[model samples]
Target chain A: MMLKSKVSIVKGLSYQGGLPMLSWVLHRISGIGIILFVGMHVAASFFVHVVGTDSNIPDLLNVFYESWGFQLFIYFCAIFHALNGLRIIVLDLWPQALQYQREMTWLEWLIFIPIYGMGVFFILRNAFAGG
Target chain B: MSARSTLRPRSVQPAWSFEYIMWFFTRVSGLTMYLLALSGVVGAFILGARTQVDLQTLLRWMFFPNRFHVEPYLDDAAFWVTAWWQIMQILIVFFAVSHGFNGLRVVIEDYVGRSFWRPLLRSVVFLLWLAMLVIAVFVILQA
Candidate 1:
């Protein structure tokens, strides 16, 4: 039974926990996502600096980065990661706050949704407005 | 009882260890980036970025603060080319690159476990981090 359970866990088919587990998983995902974006962004800036702004590469990169789809994904990752990081930091500094983890997670979502929604709205507006 | 007294305290890793140092740095650098980005946003508005540049240009300026990013949009891009903005650009590049690459290292170490590839990958990441810093700083200085 133990071996079976371990295999299931390795396969990522286990129940694990719930919200807390999801939060931890999402945190890792978002962190990786942000790093990937940053790598591309920094490289683009460096390339533009070297080749000058007249090059088509900057325009191509800008088109990809400015798209509403990419913006939504990036903004979600960035906002979620930032807020969840603060939550983790609070828990680390004040261990007693562990008792309130569920509440904090809920609070995080409460805060994240509105900010992320606003960003999404603006991104869509810009894309539709042909800007 | 006071919150300090109620806090659980344990010492597993020494403060001088690489893991410990990086753990502390991750938090510090994350907070530092927030402050830097906040300043960037405030400074951008002060310089009339909202009216002068599009969303993309404003974002580019916010992230890098390089005059080249905003100069095409503004009639007077002189303010962005000043020493103060250059300093901000350098600081943002330094903190963002270091923090990001370190996070990648941590992720690799966590998932890769004990393997020959672990050290190899870590070295690769460190080299890339160094290269990125050099390129980013050079670009900022040149701009």
Candidate 2:
């Protein structure tokens, strides 16, 4: 005998899924972070254009933007999102690739680490050297 | 047995629907922005961004290509102020703003579920997208 139930299962965020789950969560977070940064950037540029760059807001924004901390975070979000996005697209185009998801993620990091490391180096140098 | 015969046909969505169109746009626009950004970076390096500009200025130029952004750091920014760069900036603004807002809409749809807030939030995102495009274009052209 089969019985029908009205309740629905909600299988939300659980850490047990490991890397795939972490990647999915980070993708969404990075996306939102990029959008927020873009909004502020566009607004700052618009304000500077309208106010002739002498305004305090753009100056303050530049100071905040120039910080190594913010720079590293934004760069990480951007590069990670882009690389992970490419991986997702590849998987979509070739469903068979899903079987190798773990390997693909490792490849993504293999590419991501050196690129992000170089960016970090330049940013730190610029911050310390006052360039 | 051939692979085509062995596998079941996949279900397809109607291409004319809003969701379907947006899903396609997301992929296309993401690739388009990459192309545009690549061009910007290469063009900046060619235009002396490597030696003349600092890392920060080079980054700003790579992302936006606005003449004013780089002019402060360069001896001659005439190449950046040209119509070609303006066109690139405009294209970037259009694609990036549209892609970003659509992503936001997807996020809203995912979380808000079946509710009045879904449509309302979508409308808000749409209006913001429109406003962003307008302001961005205005600034680009005015520069």
Candidate 3:
């Protein structure tokens, strides 16, 4: 009897699960990621300002962009944060669509994987090849 | 740990105090980005007022990269130049995520009388930004 009911719960459209909460938590977590990357970018600019452009500042900045590891890290960060950003922006603007939130969250994640993978390929071709 | 200057109990930490410790990098990073943007704005204002475009000034402002408006408080140049960028990079990621998504999370938590569809829809938008932030950062860093 218990097993039969458990299967029905998942099969039913009304079923509640851990995903809503998980999606909520992760979405917020990614916002910080975007801010962090921007922060580093800002700090680097400051240094360039102080020293002037005659120095190795541009070269060093290029070095980071050229790095394969850094390239992948930044690319994924952009993809996840941007996709998730779209979802949260919609959620905040409209508060009545709670029902679709679960389904939308899953769709966003699915879309994110392929989008981010494509991003990785592009960065590797443009930035990593030189390094 | 010094006593917090607040009405809370000795055991109770102020909101900024605890969040500062755990999310130190992101907070600092946000500050950095804010300063950077401020600098750009200021530089642009100065340039906009100029009669003839100054080549030297333009290049300085353009390629100067991050606006170091906050660096005045940082005192440590070496740290800011190298280690700090990476630190800010990691932390900014965290803080932006937290601040941006807080709205959606709150709405979901308070979904009693609230028009549920709008906030949920907005949440989708925020999540997309989050995905872009993630995918872009990782791809850039890893590539």
Candidate that scores best on lDDT: 2
Candidate 2 per-residue lDDT, tens place, B58-122, comes to: 77887789998888878888876888899999999999889888988887777676668877998
Model 2 misplacement above 4 A = A1-13, A53-55, B1-14
TM-score of 2: 0.87
Residue A104, candidate 1: how far off, in angstroms?
1.0
DockQ of each: 0.40, 0.35, 0.03
Candidate that beats the other on TM-score, 2 or 3, i.e. the better one: 2
- Chain B TM-score for the candidates in order: 0.85, 0.87, 0.32
- What is the Cα-based lDDT of residue A110 in candidate 3? 91
Candidate with maximal TM-score:
2
Q: List the residue pairs that clash in candidate 1.
A: none
User: Given candidate 2, what's the lDDT at residue A124?
Assistant: 89
Fnat per model, in the order given?
Answer: 0.39, 0.31, 0.03
What clash count does candidate 3 reach? 147
Model 1 / residue A50 / CA error / Å: 0.9
Q: What TM-score applies to chain A of candidate 2? A: 0.84
Q: What is the C-alpha local distance difference test score of candidate 3?
A: 0.50
Off by over 4 Å in 1: A1-6, A9-11, A52-59, B1-14, B49-60
lDDT of each: 0.82, 0.83, 0.50
